[model samples]
Every structure is written in structure tokens, then in C-alpha cells.
Target: MKLYSGIDLHSTNSYLAIIDGKGKRIFHEKLPNDITTIVQRLELFAGTLQGVGQHRGCDREKA
Candidate 1:
């Protein structure tokens, strides 16, 4: 049941997607560009998250 997550981030909005080791999607949504909101979504998979990935030009230094 290993889980993974990916985010396609944008300036104003983003897409958050979660999937299992088998590549089956468990959760996906378009959400606002707020850190708290993003964290909340991710919290759903708290202890099970194996890895996470993000795409786009957002600066990782500030994250």
C-alpha cells in the first residue's frame, strides 16, 4: 500500500494527485495556491506517503 503524490503547481491554482504503487489514483483535485490547503490535502495520506513530487517552475528554496 505504498503511496505517492505529485502536484502540478501554478501561480493561482494547482492539481494534487495521489496514487498507489500500482499507479492507481486514490485522490485528485484542483485546489487553490495556499500552503495550508495543500498540506491539508496531503494530510489525508500522512503516514503512508512513500514519496512526493512536484512539477513546474516554483522555487524549491522558499518551500
Candidate 2:
């Protein structure tokens, strides 16, 4: 099944959640509060996660 990803960024760290079309949580993690780290973590789940969408400072959470 296809998958969807969402991220929530904050001051200290960012929250990430991945869910499948079937409504199952595939993977979740709180990365190093940086965009690069977020991308790297997602890459590990690239095969299962796609169509990423983020907000709340997530777009600017970069090195």
C-alpha cells in the first residue's frame, strides 16, 4: 500500500510520523531538530514512505 509522511517541528526537536494508506503507523521518530536529519531518517524508510508534508517550522528546520 502507498504511504504518507508528516512532520512537526519545534524548538528542541521535531516529531515525525509515517502512515500507510491502510491507516497503520509504519514508523515514527523524533529527529535532531534539523531538516537534514529528518531527510536522512526518512531515507531509511524511503521504500515505505512517500508524499511528505510538514509544517510548524519543519520547512525551515535545516542546517
> How many clashes in each structure?
0, 1
* Model 1 agreement with the true structure over 1-63: per-residue lDDT tens digits: 789999998988999999999999999999999999999999999999998899987567864
- Cα distance off (Å), candidate 2, residue 17: 0.6
Top TM-score model: 1
Pairs of colliding residues, candidate 1: none
Query: Highest lDDT, which number?
Result: 1
In model 2, the runs with Cα more than 4 Å from the true position are 57-63
lDDT of 2: 0.81
TM-scores of the models, in the order given:
0.86, 0.73
- Predicted candidate 1, C-alpha RMSD: 5.4
Give model 1's TM-score versus the native structure: 0.86
Superposition error at 18 for model 1 (Å): 0.2
- List model 2 lDDT by residue over 1-63, tens digit each: 678998887888888988989878888888878778888878877676658888785356568
